[model samples]
Target: MMASIQKRPNGSWRARYRDDEGKEHARHFDRKIDGQRWLDGVTAGMVTGTYVSPAAGKVTLTAFYLIWAERQVWETGTRRAMDLSVRSCSFEGVELRALKRSHVESWIKAMSAAGLAPLTIHGRVRNVRSVLRAAVRDRALSVDPSEGVSLPRKRRADMAMDIPTPEDVRRLYDGAEDWFRPVVALAAFAGLRLGEVNGLQLADINFLPRTISVLRQVQRTPGMAIEIRSPKYGSERVIPVADSLLLILSAHVENVGVYGDDNWILPGRDGGPIWPRTIAYHWDRLTARLDLNGVRLHDLRHFYASGLIASGCDVVTVQRALGHRSASVTLNTYSHLWPNADDRTRSASQSLMDGALAIPADSLRTAGA
Candidate 1:
């Protein structure tokens, strides 16, 4: 039923309505017109399915988050990140209905002032925005306060991808522990992400065809056991293994027999897939020992991509080889590494001119006089 307006004994008007849950909400207004207007708005909101019970708005952001988070279908790592992001801010105690754009903007300003990286601030802002959006969907909020909030921009230096040289990769390969060498080889030779490397299994490697099939990846969230999941969306692919990389894998297999049920190339303690943290432990030791500061294991993937670009591979080829979702992603990251259009055009013209001139042409000398 629609809201009812009544003339009160004190000459004011009372507007009252029963919510979907049969809870009554009432407001006293100075005039009958005001009460009717309020009732109309309440009716409209309810008709449009946008009505929020007066008490629902009283729930704090923290309380709402606790309720909303449990219903989300997120990966464990994603949930952990979201939890950390929520805890990083002070606005959790704010009531959902009381949250204002200024409050969100102020939170962003505080994070920026604290010298957080633009990416980190952006991530937290995104997480908070998601929660606020959910509140709107659940009718706890009329609007998302975090909408249209500007964030700090990433500097050029922060955006630059640091690709290690082949010599640096060779040094890293030589310095790594014998068991960890295959990790480096897979990353440097085949552009596999760390999780993919850790998820590698002997069955995924086809010795006859010399191809590495990236099918799955190992994921870990704090306080949870490592779990195996499919590769990052659209990143499942098969990379043709180079003979050298194949030799490294062969040697590793010979050194450590692959006899497990899962046939994990780099098995964890229980002879299942190795955890990413274990790989990180070995990687930290190797990098620290070699004094290769700031050179992460992911840099090897960049090194692999750069090598493919240097070898004249096209954007699409590199995209597929690197298991990127699309060529645009490949170009955006490695466009600078590709040869310039002007240089390629000039080289092609010069080669064509040389070939044409190579055909000796006898000069016409007045009928061979």
Candidate 2:
């Protein structure tokens, strides 16, 4: 049924109506004709079932994002990255359902115009797509406006393959602080990611057999909240502990004591989880002291892979050690580090020549005959 207009004591005319979902809304008009005009429109919409309240049509982009962020299930670091991307987005206050493909395309263009990298633009688009997809699933919108949006082709940056020469690594380690040196050695020799290193517990170490178990990772969100999560794919694998790292771990445990039954191998000064930035800061200081190229802490993982390839370890073994889900990932990432097999063609050519040319010194003398 349609609603009727009523005059209030304040002398304003108000029209009341119920939506399809049985929710009531009232609109106040200054003129009786205006209220009657609105009531006529509402009565027509009710008869045709086409009435969409202004509030429903007017949901701001910011409100939709807040709802989306609340329901998101992501790791701390990933969530933080998404939040940052949303905060930096240009379409913050536009009506969400009113968004169009051109609007999304223009937003991407604006980001590129601001000199953001293609990968960064791609990430922002992905975040927007995720929110829009959720909106579609919730029936808030009939379709995702971000669908079919095209992104610029990403240009691959020059990867950091300039791994420290063995000499440089030795010098860096020697100059590192006593407590920090072990962390560097573990990263370089064992190829542990920063989160893995911070997540290590005493039980994860096998002092007797010299092995380390990779099971969990620790990450910090934007507000410095710590979250521990299972390794990618929940992979739990054992890596052989290098002799240098084992020795360092032993001494570190002895000096620090077990701390707690929780068994964290590396804790903060007051026995909480260690900060990832603290490790990177110390690593940078060590590199500066050694006057080496400013290698990223993650690059140490690359250094470990390069060392293995250089030392004749096959890609499969390296893949397992690094806990990569696929051998192709390992191969693609480290393929440039592998020596080129094309250089070996000369050796095969010499063997073929030796077999084909049967002429000796005596045969050469008889060639004129």
Candidate 3:
């Protein structure tokens, strides 16, 4: 659309143009050149398919989030976490158009100053970036201001994972109540997540084939009832049962009594599935009673992973056993546990040389003469 400049009655220049929607926007300037420059930029944006309506981004981040969040298909737990992340960033009142890199950097600094972990600060920033990115797609903002902002580095020690010792697992198992022993076994031996264990049913276990099928997980949100959902994306798998674990599960069934094939394998005291919070409460009490400090229930899964790596399982095998979505995920988490590639290469070369250079006993005796 062609922009027009005119001299206003007050001796100022007015630059006006009609947008694609036929809406007229006018700006007054002290000089004709300045008005022309503004009009040129606006038209250029339109020509480049980058035009954003001046009034579209008037809504604050908080207001836009309310509308945008309603349209998202996230699970209850995910939605709750997303809301918390958005609130933690403290950018609710900032308008989408007014959001700047400075605002994002300042929030990161404030969160760092408040002693929040670098991972947590990054998460909050990522959540806010999601909203801003959506605004860009909706034409509420011409660009996402959160892009390219520097984030705090996570400490190396914080990224390190520790596997629980066998003694630690045995102590927890022996000290735990009989009913809770199965929970410990499932995590430490089978590598089932706490949620997956909570969601297990008698039907999911195959005693004939000695395999356990992981199909679902129990998730909880504050002020909401527990929901059984599909296992975390690509986590649905069947793990082959080791004889030791099979024996433990067999004993558990005989001693605990099978309520029904459809019933929960580990039900609450009231015959319902165990709540995550309740499990956490019991686990904390048990750990403290045993004086096992710095040991988390999740560590049991790491123990299982370490075991797989120690047994010479290949990357793809371990990935499938642990229900990881990709081999890269398995490698990233447990690469340290695997033997060094250089060591393997050296050992293989030595074996090859030994076979190729073998000498007969007669030859050895002649050499001695």
For TM-score, the strongest prediction is 3
Question: Model 3 compared with the native: what TM-score?
Answer: 0.87
How do these models rank on lDDT, best leading?
Answer: 1, 3, 2
Q: What is each predicted model's overall lDDT from 0 to 1? A: 0.86, 0.76, 0.85
Model 2, which residues run further than 4 Å from truth?
A: 1-60, 137-162, 224-236, 251-264, 308-320, 323-369
Worst 10 residues of 2 by lDDT: 155-164
Every model: Cα RMSD to truth: 6.1, 8.7, 4.8
- Model with the higher lDDT, candidate 2 or 3: 3
As a whole number from 0 to 100, the lDDT of residue 242 in candidate 3 is 87
* Candidate 3 local lDDT, 1-369, one digit each (tens): 867999999999999998878888899999999999999899887877667778777888888888999999877776887898788766778887788889888988999999998988878888889988988888788888889999999755325687789999999999998878988999999999989989888888898899999999987867777877887764899999788887887888789855534578775536667788778888999999999868889899999989988888899988888889899988878888888989799878767867898655468679968
lDDT by residue (tens digit), candidate 1, 1-369: 557989989999999989887888999999999988988888888888777777889999889999999998876677888988888877889888788999889989999999998989989999988998898899998888888989999755325778888888999999987888889999999999999998888888888998999999998866678888878754889888798898899999999766468888886867677888899988988989989978999999999998988888888889988988788878777787878889899878767876987533333344466
lDDT of 3: 0.85
lDDT of 3 at 367: 98
User: How many residue pairs clash in each candidate at the backbone level?
Assistant: 0, 0, 0
Off by over 4 Å in 3: 20-22, 47-50, 157-159, 259-261, 325-328, 349-369
